[model samples]
Target: MTEFLDALVAHAFLQKALIAGLLASIGCGLIGPFVVVKRIAFMAGGIAHAVLGGMGAALYFGFDPLAGALVAALVSAILMGMVHLVWQAQEDTLISALWAVGMAIGILFIAKTPGYQADLMSLLFGNILLVPDRALVWMIALDLVLALTIAACYRPFLALAFDAEFARLRGLPVTVFYLLLLCLVALTVVLLIQVVGLILVIALLTLPAATAGHYVRSLGTMILIATLLGAFFTTLGLALSFGPDLPAGPTMILLAAAAYILSASLSHGLKQRRARLQIRDG
Candidate 1:
């Protein structure tokens, strides 16, 4: 363990990756509950992919890709939120339309760019080992912001999630909460793109929360457990990346997926055993 730690910190890239992973996990842990409770995994996917368009456009236009992702995510979140407010009829259609349009724009922008096909693949699939110090700073700030804001608004958010109707009856601002949730999710998506890219970002965000839910009843415990799990996967994946030369993001996602599968199987067997015990007692 000491030897592995020594080798890992020997390189500056590994240090950046470790710091970035820690920051990313903080935000992912905080906002992951909303994704699970609101069941917005699909919407998260749409948002993640839509950022691709933003990034492609940014790269084409000679701006930082992070700027593009933030702008696109915020705009998409507001517009997507408004769609449900306006029609309340075809959310899936509208979200899907936005997603497709965003991806189309990304593709076109990438195609328009000259002499750069493989260059952007790092951003697309997450090259954690390539993360720069400036980007690492941004991740840390965003993680703190997400964590603090979530902690402040947690109760109302919980109220909104389980029973929005009741929350509304109590004169709580469901619309504001809903939009706030979407905005936070957008910020989180942008942060995650740096950690795992768009392809595996959703997996990292959702799987840890789900696996933690199997054993945790309270949201606080759930978030803590998920953070630990995310950190574990990130570290292990980095070690594996060192060995197999595989991309870190997908390796981490696969690790998280394995955890999910194991948790689910364990939960199922425990439930079955409990049922058997109940029957015997009866």
Candidate 2:
């Protein structure tokens, strides 16, 4: 721990990595609750994996990979939103197809690209230490966009998440809000890619929020708790991995998974105890 702190003070890369993680946590905290409540993790995962196709194509065409990811994420989210709206019965099948096709396209593009493709593995798994200054600026911009959008649409989004039919009856544009929510999810997925990469992004996105949900009944409180948990997990994982030279992305995910498990178990146990006491009292 001491060595980690000393090195943290000495390394600019470590500072950038820490800042990136915290910034990523903001998006995760904000979007993750909606994901958990709406049961849209699968859709979000599809959008996330689909980003690699954009990234790979961007590399091949000599464009910014992040730009490619943004485009792909938005497109996938929109398509998925439409499918959910029109073909609810076949939603999962279409999403799964998108997920597989996106990954395959990305792999093919990467394979055909000339040279070593040194950064490919990092994009797949993630290396937070490699986050550059420019990326941090982009993260900050994206975070602000997310915060403002959520602030403006909070009530509508809350209505969309729980009881969409009711929202529709209340004269809310449920379809527009629903699509908008998915677009936000797409953006959040892109933001998280830097912290945990494409493959493990879903775990980090959902786990912290899910853990928070175990304790909180209010959506607002859940987001607050999830955001804090995400910050703690990412920062501690980075520090712990620094000492052992472990892979930072996987380390952070493992920590989050463990936390979710512990929280779930405790919540379950408490529920059971409450039930038993109620029975005894009766």
Candidate 3:
């Protein structure tokens, strides 16, 4: 651990990885709980996978892949949101179709691209150490945007998450807010792609939030706690990965999964113990 900390000061890639990881944590922390609470994890997954179509198109046409991914993600988010809202029965089926279609489009485009094709593993599984300085700047800018948006619309989002019909009754534009939330989800998926890639992005987004949810009652509190937990997990996972020469994405996710299991088990034990005590007293 001490060696890793010292290496961070000496290594540029390590520093960049650390910065990118933390920035991604901030975005994931803010958006993750909303995803879990609103039960939109599947929708978010669809959008994340759907970004691949844009990626493939970009590769085929010699354009920026991230830009392509961002556009694709937003389009997918909007499509999924509309499908979910307008035709509730067909929502799952449509999202599944979009998920498959996006991957198919990406594969087709990539196959058509000329020359030595770049390795797709990094885009699929992620290599945070390869994050460029420009990408870090983009992540920071995204963090700012997310922070402002959440601050401005926290209450309405909270209401929508808990009870959309009631929020609508209270004059909130439920459909608009719902769509806006999906857009944010799209942005978050894009932000996290550089760190965890499209394949495992949802796990990185959800695990910390799920762990934090065990202890926190309020949504805001869960976000704050999840953010911290995410940073810790990523930093620790990065350090551990350095020793074993492991993939950061899977390593970080494993650490987070461990934490979630620990938190859930501990919480369940405490609840059971308290129940037993109460019963004995009675």
Candidate 4:
């Protein structure tokens, strides 16, 4: 560990990865709790996958892939939100269809591209160490946007998450808020792709929040706990990956999954024990 810390301080790529992990953790911790509470985890996954269509088009057209991904993600998110508004019962089916179609479009475009795509695997599986300095700039900007937006509209989001109908009845512009939340999710997917890739982003987003849910009562507290857990997972995972030369994204996610399982099991066991003690006292 000491040697690894020494190397981390000595290396610039490692420094970037560390900063990237911390920023991504903070962003995911904040957004992920709302995602789980709102039951939009699947929709978030759909957007993550669908962004590939934009990436492929950008790759083929000699444009910025992240720009393409953001556009694609926003469009898909809006479409999904509209579908949910119009046909709530059929939204899942539509999301699944969109997910498949998006992936197909991306594959077709990539296949048609003439040159070899060296960064393709990194896009799919993620390589935090490969994150460019420019991309870090974008990530920091997006994190600021997300943080400010959440802070400004926290109450409306809380109402919407806990009870949309109530929020609507209270004249909170439910549709607008809901769509806005989805848009944020799109941005989050883009941001998190750096840390965990499109394929594993959802896990990083949810697991920390979910594990925090086991211990925290309020949404704010949950986000704080989740953020700390995310940082812990990311830092440890990156350090562990350094020795084995393994992919950091998957390593972080696997560690998060392990943490979630342990936290959940422990929470359940404690609850059961408390119930038994309560019965004995009675």
Candidate 5:
């Protein structure tokens, strides 16, 4: 840890990587709870995986991969949102198709693209140490966009997450808000790709928020705790991996998974104890 800190002090890349992680945490923290409450993790996964198709196409055609990813993510989110709203019965099948097709398209594009594709592995699994200054700037921009959107739509989003039908009855433009929420999730996924890559992105996105859910029932509190946990996990994982020469992305995910397991077990135990005590009192 000491060595890692010392290196961090000396390394501009490490500082940028750390900043990227924190920015990602902010996005995850804000949007993840709504994802959890609305049970849209699978849909988010579809968007995340679909991003690869955009990246692959961009790489093949000599465009910015991140820009391609942003476009793809937004497009997929809107398509999925419409399918979800109008084709409720076929939502899962359509989303699953999108998930599989997007990945398949990306792989094909990557295979056809000439050259070594040195960054391919990083795109799939992430290498935070390699994050460029441009990416950090992009992340900051996305973070601001995400924070502002959430701030503006907090109430409608809260209502959508808990009860979309009721919110619609109240004339809350449920469809628009639902689509907006999915788009936010799409942005969050893209924001996180540099930290954990496309494959492991969902884990980082949901795990901290899920763990926070075990401790708090309030959505706002869950977002706050999840954000803090994300920062801790990313920083610690980066530090630990730096000394051991481990892959940072997977290392961060392992830490989050372990924390989630511990939190779930403790929450379960407490619930059982409370139930037993109530029975005895009765």
Candidate 6:
């Protein structure tokens, strides 16, 4: 294990990947509590896919893909948030349509581009082996912003998540807060596109938070557990990718899923044992 760690650090890419994972873990851990409680998984997924259009525009116009993706994601988020104000049938349907359109736009652009030889595998899944010091710095800045956002909006977000009625009754500007959450999530989705790509971004956002909620008694505890789990899974996926020849994004999702399964099994076993103990006592 020590030899492997040393080897990973020796390579600049692996080192940067690991560092970015840690930095991302911090933000995800902090913001994830609200994400889970608010039931915004689908919204997050929508934003993740919708970034494809921005990616297409960026590539077509001769700019960085990341810049384009960020633009696309932010726009998608605002559009999705507007769904509630527009009094639509269901926000879900609108989000689904938006997501498909974004994907279609991306495909169209990719098809039209001449001599397009991008390693689709890396962008579709993830290529941790490509993480660099520059990406690391950007990730750190993202985390810092997230930390501040959470610190400032904790109460408003918490109220909005568990009980919007109560928050609105308290004059909490529920609409503004809700939009802010989605916008932040969209930003997170954009950043994660580089780490895990659009395919598995939703999993990264939800799995740790979901799994952590099982054992943790308090919201704060749950966030800590989720953050730790996210970091662990990220590292485990990187290690697993060293073999299996699998892409980092899918591997990370698999690792997170495995953790969720483990947590569920343990919870089930404990429940069963408690039932047995009650029977014996009676």
Question: On residues 1-282, what C-alpha lDDT tens digit does candidate 2 reach at each position?
Answer: 999899999999999999999999999999999999999999999999999999999888888888999999999999999999999999999999998888888888888889727888898888899998888888998899999999999999999998999999999999999999999999999999998999999998899999999999899998999999999999999999999999999999999999999999999999999999999998
- The pairs that clash in candidate 2 are none
Highest-scoring model, TM-score: 2
Model 5 ranges off by over 4 Å: none
Q: TM per model?
A: 0.95, 0.98, 0.97, 0.97, 0.97, 0.92
Estimate candidate 4's alpha-carbon lDDT, on a 0 to 1 scale. Answer: 0.91
lDDT of 3: 0.91
In model 6, which range of ten residues has the least summed lDDT? Answer: 114-123
User: What TM-score does candidate 6 reach?
Assistant: 0.92
| Tens digits of per-residue lDDT for model 5, 151-221 | 99889999999988999999999988999999999999999998999999999989999999998979999
Better of 2 and 3 by lDDT: 2
lDDT of 4 by residue, 144-250 (tens): 98999999999999999999998999999999999999999999899999888899999998999999999887999988998999899999999999987899999
lDDT (tens digit, per residue) of candidate 1 on 1-282: 455478786988888898888788877888887788788887887888888889889989989888899889888888788886786789899899988898889888988988767866776788888888888887887788788888899998899878999999999999999888888888999898897997788998899989988988888898898888888888888777766578889888999999899999999899999999999998
Q: How much is 15 displaced in model 1, in angstroms?
A: 1.0
Q: Answer with 1 or 6, whichever has the higher lDDT.
A: 1
* Model 2 lDDT, residue 38, Cα: 94
Note the Cα lDDT for every prediction shown.
Answer: 0.85, 0.93, 0.91, 0.91, 0.91, 0.80
Off by over 4 Å in 2: none
Total clashes in model 3, counting residue pairs 3 or more apart in sequence or in different chains: 0
Window of ten residues with lowest summed lDDT in model 5:
111-120
Candidate 1 regions with alpha-carbon error over 4 angstroms? 1-4
Candidate 3 wrongly placed segments (more than 4 Å): none
